[model samples]
Target: MSPLPGPRARGHRLPMVTALLLALVGTLGLTGCASLGTAAKYDGGRLRIDGTDLSFRLPEGWERRDNEELADALAGSEIDDELAERGGISSSQQDAILDEVVLFAVGPGGSSLNVLTSSEALPPRAVLIDQVESFGGTDVRETDFPTDVGDSFAVAYRLDAQGVQADLLAMVIDTGDRLSVITVTTGSRAETDRVAEVIRTSLALR
Candidate 1:
């Protein structure tokens, strides 16, 4: 819709859904671990499924990061321009929310993962549908993804900007407490397939 906003050498106009995937991927691929050393709730080694004792392992080479790294990534990104042009959330607002709750992962070959959750009392299914409904992308395809834990939702899409295509996979998992939005973006379809395999196979009950 917004002409894809000048295809950043590295970035996306990430919103809650957008912000979680696009911007973060841009940052991870754009800059190295800017945070360098800090701990976040969700480490790349394993992430606990909320409202359950189950925890799943992230694929090797995935590094969990802190918000500071995200901030650093955004500093060198064109994500702001994309967001502005797309009529998405302001950088400041995005920054604030990002600080509150976001589990990030930087993986091999310019791939990234973003996790966002809310503790506010609400139905998980409703929130998941809301997130999916709000998503906007090119060549979008969605389906149910079955995990060892349960049936989750997955969306595959392409975000094209400046001739650079970001192949993305967004998986929404609802175990109980609240819905969890996990997004993965890669530089190509092959890469996407590899990463998706790692996630689907690696995600399991602790």
Candidate 2:
């Protein structure tokens, strides 16, 4: 089988792992909503993501989405090809789903911040690189930086396909039982750097 397209692939093509992550996030939302009885709250200029012990300060002019919106965005998308085949839909079903999918996003379309969680306990570095490579990323690079919450590793790469050139910054944090993948996507390298830096520095774990 041919490899799945990356996040920024032409049209609505997103990687299988990404689709899996989104599914996980949706499950977290539903499960958390039912049991936790809490929702994302805004206080002191920060948007605290509900359903989990995660929160971040929202950057200037940035917007925050709720768990319901996230679920809506990932709705009807299979987490993997096996599921897709079993469901009798195209393996790339997410391509059509993403056309209307918008998660807990911040910033404009060209540049934005997205967060997803995984239950797997893995090194942040491996998760970061594997995510980029899995999405058909090229010119991948790794770096580290300090954040208000803790030290985190970042993976940056480019996706140039179908005449669309987009840059992505995958900021990964391994918080014991879960992996937080915060992606910053933009059309220009400078925008990618600027947006990611603002959000990264403002992050505060609570």
Candidate 3:
């Protein structure tokens, strides 16, 4: 309209167009960031074991496996049929039910501990300590039966059970209705000691 818009005016219009495109891009980026920030929430402590929600703090960089796989690894000479008969279930069902029994003993240098509900009355704390010591190949460094935390005890030790050597530690927490035993076995003395501390620090019910 005014002098038909000279070349200089056209160049100015191009810059304005570029500015508008930049603004649109910026707006889109902000929207994306906001969406990502407002994503769903989850309880980090809850782990899915055999489709069951079991709460525990997962150690960093450790891998998780199913019960069947673990049972196969720690099977020994135990017959699947015999195990199932005790629980009135098939081998496959028993595998699913006991999936959480075996946990990470420590990859490479770790051993496995099978957790089970105390079937024949609650065994003495000394019995557990002795079993762990015998299996771990280490003496019990410390044991404390805290009355406050479900009358459970924390046991620390160094073990060299079988060919695999490790620093083993466990928290035997029994809540009358349920008993949870968290055991950590390290590959080397140093790694075992480090993980033992981590397990102790990360120990919690919820």
Clashes of 1: 4
Candidate 1, residues 80-99, lDDT tens digits: the string is 55644443567676566566
In candidate 3, which residue ranges exceed 4 Å CA deviation?
1-45, 48-54, 74-116, 119-122, 133-136, 144-149, 193-206
> How large an RMSD does model 3 have?
26.8
Off by over 4 Å in 1: 1-45, 49-54, 120-136
Local error of candidate 3 at 66, Å?
A: 0.6
Ranking of candidates on lDDT, top first:
1, 2, 3
**2 against 3, candidate with superior TM-score:** 2
- The C-alpha stretches of model 2 lying farther than 4 A from their native spots are 1-16, 19-44, 66-103, 124-127, 148-151
Model 2 pairs whose backbones collide? none
Q: What is the lDDT of candidate 3?
A: 0.40
